[model samples]
Target: MIPPATPSPSAPKPSRQRQIGGLEFILLMGLLQALQALAVDSMLPALGTMAVDLGARDPNQRQLVVGIFLICSGLGCLLPGTLADRYGRRPVLITCLTSYILCSTACALVTNFDQLLVLRAILGVACAGLMVLPAAIIRDRHEGDAMARLQSTVGIVFMVVPMIAPSVGQAVLLVASWRWIFGVMALLGSLILFWMATRLPETLRPEFKQPIAPRKLAMTMGAIITTRSAAGYVLGMALIQGAMFGYINSSQQLVAEHFGAGARFPLIFAGMAACMACSNFTNSRIVEKFGARRVSHTALLIYIGTSALQFYIASQPNETLWEFVPMMTVNMCLLGFLGSNFTSIALQPFARSAGAAASAQSFIRMVLASCLGSMVGQAFDGTARPLAFALMVAGLGCLVLVLFSEKGRLFRRLLPPGTPRPIA
Candidate 1:
């Protein structure tokens, strides 16, 4: 009998010396992602004050504060993954965080809206690493259901940031100028940077590293776009994410002025975010047992049903906060399931090129989502109708794309029973 082939000595071990405790790994990944959430959600409470401070004349322009950041981040996301694939995840991430800290400080001191926006654009570029790297890191460590579970677990912590971020911003505005919110953001970025530099191990395999060549990069990206499973899920994610971003952009207006939540806007927003956190917690528990497709596909259907009802409610002439908030909250909860699972599924096909795949998908997804969000946000006319309509359309689009990817099938596991899961 032939002897068993020996494993190559020079092969890179993904878990070699990188095996921090599972809980620590999850927390680090989650906090890295939460930085972006904090950047967006915390600023929600202060958009009005910041606009007045910066001499903004048009109310619609204030959405640009959030909108510009998201768009720039999307554009910036296109490169980090390619560079990370060549250089390494650790160095690239550290640079991004350093930039984030510096940009946050500059934003705190801006004298005018244009200066603030320019700084925010740069800051968004830095923040792109926060969005892309965490997913790539998880991809480096796990795939399929394990990846979905890990993403959901991290999402539990990520969702917590949005839950309390508005409250944090509101509290800051109570004692200081809205600019102090940027100061707080800078401080948090500093702490996260320190934690990352000291504790997180690099996960990129040695063999996966490649030169940053244009032809190679273009080919990798082309492959990603051509892969039906990946392309479909990426498009679906962008559509759903567009709806979520729309809600984020218009949420303050809908909850505070239109629904008359006013000073209680932070509390109402936190309550809705709390439901999403709960959804992530629940997804973490059940994703592995039922599979990512089954959980997310079912959630997507429920989301569509919920969104249609929300549109109906919003169209009523005398709609109340009670009627609106619950449906919106449910839709947000469903999002917790969709975001991580769709990401995992789209990424399943790319093992060596995970970083590039993540980069391309994030760039496309965020740019498209931000544009759709800007449109939906601008359509706000002192009511929730536009946001609701956008969400319903998003859900339908997502379902269609998913159907195309699955070849008219849904909720079927690709893996058979008794297959052993690889340890991360």
Candidate 2:
């Protein structure tokens, strides 16, 4: 099979004014992407409530609420790409968003833990479109370092949602039960759906459309698996995300139970998230100057170092919150520098199959990361040791994957012929 042709230097650019303006496009895509984060982070403060109300036998079992959603979301991601390629991005997205809204509402009414888990799984599937489609939309218009810059910009804005979600959840909990969290999610989903329906244009070009054939889909997915850069980066991303999810799954317990920060959980959580957001903003500004690979590689080393320090701190007797929070915050901030760059590199190979490519990437990252994270979370022994060790291990694994992906090269910029390098 022939590889898809790379867009030429002289190729016509899509008009930003024809569809949506640049700033509005970024904001819409950022908010759309943030829904997934909002769903996960906003519920952190309520995990204990959920466990108690749902009659969970083990405190750790509460994590399944987050883990199952990620797993099912990964499962859901497998199909939207093929569907978006065959149909149009707008239709597939709208349908999925509607399903997400309904699922969120259903979650608010579930009476038992099992019932809630089932709904959350379905919600994950519905949200799969939201996670995969927006990136495809960006790919529909941009590529290479330009795409990297836009992705980092979106990350900068998108990080704000996670920064505030815990506070939002806590606020809801102050007046109502945890059920209201889902209700608020539903409302937010509806607003995004409406905004998308009104403003988002069909970004996919007609010539790039693919038919929904089994053989064709298989070949495309196989291509993704066999492509060295894409596969390596995807695996590397999954490992890094595994570390992030470990922190997310255990954050509330770490802050409240381990450090006695129960009343200040939201504030502390928000502060950590703010660190990540600031890092993303910084990356957006500098990625163009230093290139995505260089920036991401540098950040990965820092991440590994920070993780090692965090593990040592967690291993000590009577570790202070001061020691743990700062190290973890720095580790998370490094992640902000890595996520978009890794994704841009992985998606660099696809043109016509952007949706399928995005789907496959999301599927692997979410599913594998969720499993690793769940393991770390369940190993909680009334200390931060498990989480810290898991991160350090994950960081080492991620470095190896990156090495393999780049063929043992690190911090090098390789731009395609005629592709413009980012300027300072």
Candidate 3:
């Protein structure tokens, strides 16, 4: 039976400070988010060279190289959040980053396609930890509006890495071999490890640290599945994420080979990344006025809308590169807007179990996105049309999921602080 009415005097005081220094938290968010994008997109510019070097007979298999890594990454995302719940976020993050660094090095060293695939799988496992811990850390200190603002700040920081990552990969490939990409990743992983070791603190209080025993883990997973509100928003986020994977995986090949842009493909990719960064920055500014749910919901509509237009454009004959690039950039920016806000909404409901919640979210997102991205990559035809079609379909599906999740409208009073009032 429900307990008798508790007096207002008996209610525990709400703590004002929920997280660490704002800038530090933002950087932390950036590094962790960077790993997810870097692990997949960093190798994009080199996919062609990678295929030739590894002597792969099938051209489509090139995308598999990226897809396989993501599959493992998605699988890896499963454990870290819960482990962070049990062991504390710092230790779990360190361990995962260490494992990722080693796996990334292995990616560089692998001589065979099978070996490379296995290494990518291993990298995926390591990435799970890095992917979820930051979200938990954010939850440790803030909720509702405060959480939204902090996350938006982090999103701005997180935005830059993915935008420039492919361009960076392309630039790297000019002076180095494909293996060196892994070497660079090794360096990134090491730096992130060192940074965490020195700067990161344990955010889950002693009273909150749960044991990693199988029973407890199972219980936590069950609770998450039962949390309908949390589940709905993340599903929407996952679809949006899958769309990104579809584009990044196919972009370099589509531009360099299909469009004959050659070395200029990096520049084209950079242009898109720049636009995404701008979108993230814009979200941070307007999130307070428009609210995360309203912004994200509207952005998803735009995201899908832009993709629909792009699809129609793709079907037309003799479309110039100039025609396609503008629309694609717009589509990715739409993604940037939705990415952070949707995630913030997903994480809003579970302040106490941020670590496990973050992990579950990451696992679902990465797994779904990886599978979809891989399929899109394998489906790539000589023209840009297939990529456009995949994006449109993903965008449309994401919209449906969001609508169903929210029951055909947006949520009211989305959280952490400085969260703008809801628009709809």
Candidate 4:
């Protein structure tokens, strides 16, 4: 055709670079993070089946399937950033995805509860790479509220996976055994691994690459701990995540047993998750306008207020699903505002050491959060009391940490020098 005849010398190259640089880049990063959410959420429906089949004696012990995975994921978060910094993002990511595929496959074949837990722990370790690397990648390209906006956008997309993950698990359970869920995880991981190998470039710049020295690692970690904004926000994020996990751990039981939702639990859970997705989408739009600190601080106050109301309502006799669901949905929505913003704020101080900083932040946050979540989950008393109370305490704890990080400031439009403030 005429178009194919002769290309002008002034014509731009087919934008091959732009393909993975803009929307595709955000979508890819979102999918990478969604792998972690999928791993956890998709297994929720199968916990009871797994416990019974695997000979777990206590009902509380079923939570270990989730708790142990989180604990191990936290433990493994320390290494990926160092590896990513040394070798490069692409290689480290591919290796981790391969390990994830293998571990998930192994998890499908475990013969006992202990064996399954061991494999899941290893799988969680693989997932840590997926969790930490995306943040580093985002930091590689953008910073400040722009980074927060991108993170929230990713969260908006990533939240969709969790919203449907339980339903996907339930669908699997309807026709196949729980083991098939892990098989599905393996399949998805394989596909993503292939996509990544083909499309994902080395986002780590040559100048940013560093040798994996023990002294250097220690110094970087010390810097992270010593930085007020990083440390405070990281701790605040940890508490908020811990509180979220508490709800996750107890969700199936609370919905099925307490609310009598039974087979409808997946739909109920999906609705709550959808609230989060909406909130993330909304936060992505507004964070640039209000700044991360102002938006998140305001959301945190609402979260604290919601937690108090939820606790009060949960304590009252004859609490209905209508009331509980709305309250929980609001809480989740508030969390949507907090999670990505908190992460962006925490990681803002370290550009050169983004990988290491992300790893340390993930490690500390996951460990503490998982512990708090496990405690709340173990305290499940066949009522909503434990979850509601834990959330309230977590909200208060997060507030304190945020205050510490902000040095008594709240709702301030803080940004780096030379950054343009958003129009009010």
Residue 264's lDDT in candidate 2:
87
lDDT of each: 0.85, 0.84, 0.76, 0.84
Per-residue lDDT for 52-112 in model 2, tens only?
A: 9988889888888888888787877877777897797989999988988998999898888
Candidate 3 residue 118 Cα shift, in angstroms, is: 0.6
In model 3, the runs with Cα more than 4 Å from the true position are 1-29, 141-149, 199-201, 213-232, 344-355, 408-424
The runs of at least 3 residues in candidate 4 whose Cα sits more than 4 Å from the true structure, single-residue gaps closed, are 1-26, 137-153, 201-208, 348-355, 415-424
TM-score of 3: 0.82
TM-score of each: 0.86, 0.86, 0.82, 0.87
| Candidate with maximal lDDT | 1
Listed per candidate, the RMSD to the true structure in angstroms reads: 6.1, 5.8, 7.2, 5.4
How many residue pairs clash in model 3? 14
Q: Judged by lDDT relative to the true structure, which candidate is superior, 1 or 3?
A: 1
In model 1, which regions exceed 4 Å deviation? 1-26, 135-153, 198-208, 415-424
Clashes of 1: 0
